[model samples]
Target: MKAAAFDYAVPKSIAEATALLGSNGAATAAIAGGQSLLPMLNLRVALPDLVVDLGRLEELKEIAATRTNIRVGALTTHAAIEDGKLPEAFGGLMQKVASKISYRAVRNHGTIGGSVALADPAADWPGCLLALGAQ
Candidate 1:
């Protein structure tokens, strides 16, 4: 089944996005990669009246590596991690885990944050991230 009709918003900043979400509350859904959310939407498991897309939020798509930490933004795709675009501080573990996420097609569209948020029992990222002591 296809998703029901819904309003959409592309917030330019995290503050705007959060405000939108806060106002919409139960009626809204935040869409980053949409890999996990879209399927649920299609199956009617999620029937949000509004979808707040974070696609235009460039800051959320970033992967910043510091001397002591690697900051992965909420919208960073698994494919980026698999492609070695993230900080080398992660060593090879992130790529190894990313390569094992379902398939290349899914990895290309799925965000690490989205994967963790879903908290699928069988998901690889969550376990790997946990083992790596990620916050």
Candidate 2:
């Protein structure tokens, strides 16, 4: 399983990364930690012509608490949340889910957005997110 040839670039912001993706068309992909994307690429499940790294996007890495609800950034790592670094409302829940994630290594690399995007029914957070109305 070999991945297709592709161009790689780390964008400083989401706007720049989105621009790269738009320019690269449907074959483009945004890679965060790459722990998941690399395996998909190797298995030939994905063959992007452009890989826009979102790891450097500070805005997407933030986890903040607002009046409406707690905000888990798209690129926020499971480990970060698991380490009790998130808001008080989500702190215990994050730890519970983080402990049961695929694995500690994968959890460290996985993200809230990645899990949500995959929409895997068996994923732990889906049920909780749904029950708690975590939009």
Candidate 3:
């Protein structure tokens, strides 16, 4: 199915993105990775007047490691987690969970943020995130 016509924007920063979303309000949808949102858009389940693409925000793709915590960016893909890119503090729990999410295609492009945001009952990340006490 063809997706509904919509305006698209790639915001360079979180502030700009938030401003765009706020301006569009109910008519805008933020897109990152597009693994989940693409399917929904194609299925006509999500019809937004404006689709804000956050994929270009490099800051959001960063996975910073700290002494006490590992801060994962919104665009951190399942493949990155599975490849052991995150810190060892988690004891490989996220890697194990990431490896188990759907298939390789999904793993390569699907992100932790998207999975958690979608919160599908069958999605694995939500359970893992909750178990890990992630916010």
Measure candidate 3: CA RMSD: 1.1
Assess each prediction's global lDDT (C-alpha) against the native.
0.88, 0.81, 0.88
Off by over 4 Å in 2: none
Q: Poorest 10 consecutive residues of model 2 by lDDT?
A: 85-94
How well is each residue in 8-55 modelled by candidate 1, as lDDT tens digits?
999878999999989877889988889989999999999999999987
Q: 1-135 in candidate 3: lDDT tens per residue?
A: 999999999887899998998987888988887888999999999999999998888898899977778899989999999998888677788888989888898889988888888889998988888888887
TM-score of 3: 0.94
- Evaluated against the true structure, the overall lDDT of model 3 is 0.88
CA lDDT of 96 in candidate 2?
Answer: 86
Decide which is better by TM-score, 1 or 2: 1
Query: What's the distance in Å from true for residue 115, model 1?
Result: 0.9
Task: Compare the candidates by TM-score and give the number of the best one.
Answer: 3
Q: For every model shown, what is its TM-score relative to the native structure?
A: 0.92, 0.88, 0.94
